[model samples]
Target: MGRLSTHILDTSNGRPAKGVRIELFALEGDKRHPVATEMTNADGRTDAPLMTGATFRTGTFELLFHVGEYFRSFGAPLSDPPFLDVVPIRFSIAEPDGHYHVPLLVSPWSYSTYRGS
Candidate 1:
């Protein structure tokens, strides 16, 4: 069975980025449709897979991470307008039954992501 999952790590804090907001979107042509909105738990991961089973498909998608709000909540010293605010990661799924783990390592200043196991 194929599934989509994600997690956030606060590289600056050396811990999971708890309570960050994540928005999922499915892109079709030039339009983006909202799929789901999830928040990171204590482990900096969603409670369940973002997409699975019938809901999971091979197509283009985007994951929007609200890192600015997350840093502010913890009193991180950032400029009036944070350098890295809402981080948008756009990717595509090619296999119908492959697990896609997109994990984000981020901070108020910068961020990175990759296709994990």
Candidate 2:
């Protein structure tokens, strides 16, 4: 399971998105503040889990993915106004003590994310 950490995969290229910038935010009273920032490794995972054991909290959170730039860097051709631009995946951490795996399988035109192992 993802546990306190998580991973993402680019299905378009069949590899991890190394160096991709990832930002995590906590949604609070209409104000979103940066909670953490990291880059995906060669395995499309962060060097450390987004949430550590001591501070895993239950609340609404957001992940901003620079998909357009990521695809372009990989040399993936896109149409004149690419279908998918910056993608924002939002979810809730219902249980802080449990592991959470949110994996993204993405492409230029489409994408999918779910609670993963």
Candidate 3:
């Protein structure tokens, strides 16, 4: 069975981005329906997959990561309007039965992500 999961790595600190807020939404037309909200664990991963098996759908979805506050908590010097604040990752589950591991490697000024296992 396949599932959807994500994790965050603070590239600046070289550690897991623990305690960062994350929100998941299902996008339809011009509306975004809330699906799930979770915080990164000590290991930088959510306690559970965002979606799994019977509940996983194939379509557009979005993951919003609140990164500015996270960096501020660590006292990173950033502009009033941080370069990277609400990092939004939009993707599609072309194959719902295939595991989708979307991991984010981020810093105050940059971020990257890719599909994994």
Candidate 4:
């Protein structure tokens, strides 16, 4: 079965980012449809796969990570307007039956992501 999953790491603090809000969206051309909203757990992972089974399909998708709010809660010394607010990672999936792991390594000022196992 195919599935989509994600996790976040607080690069600044060198730990799993817990309680971060993540939003999933499916994109079609100029349209973006809401898919799922999830919160990272203690392990920086969602309780369940964001997309799985029949809902998992091949196409473009976006994962929005609310890192600014998370940093503020932890009292990170961010600027009045943080350099990195809501981080958006957009990518495409070509194989419907392949497991796709998208992990975000983020800080108050920067973030990066890549397709993982």
The TM-scores of all predictions, comma-separated, are 0.98, 0.88, 0.96, 0.98
lDDT of 4 by residue, 6-98 (tens): 999999899999999999999999999999999999999999999999899999999999999999997999998998889999999999899
List candidate 4 segments past 4 Å from native.
none
Pick out the ten consecutive residues of candidate 4 with the lowest summed lDDT: 108-117
Tens digit per residue, CA lDDT, model 2, 1-117: 324566778787788877677788989879998988888888989998888666678888898877777777767899867788678899988875678777777888888888875
Ranking of models by lDDT: 1, 4, 3, 2
Q: By TM-score, highest first, what's the ranking?
A: 1, 4, 3, 2
Measured by TM-score, how close is model 2 to the native structure? 0.88
Which candidate should be chosen as best, given TM-score against the real structure? 1
Give RMSD (Å) of candidate 3 vs. truth: 0.9
Over the stretch 42-112, how does candidate 3's per-residue lDDT look in tens digits?
99999999999787889999999999989998799899999999999999988868899999999999999
Per-residue error (Å), model 2, residue 31 = 0.9
lDDT of each: 0.96, 0.79, 0.93, 0.95
Q: Write the per-residue lDDT of candidate 1 for residues 5-100, one digit (tens) a residue.
A: 999999999999999999999999999999989999999999999999999999999999999999999799999889989999999999999999
Q: Cα RMSDs of all predictions?
A: 0.5, 2.1, 0.9, 0.6
Candidate 3's error at 45, in angstroms? 0.4
lDDT of 3 at 92: 93
Residue 105's lDDT within candidate 1 is 100
Which regions of candidate 1 deviate over 4 angstroms? none
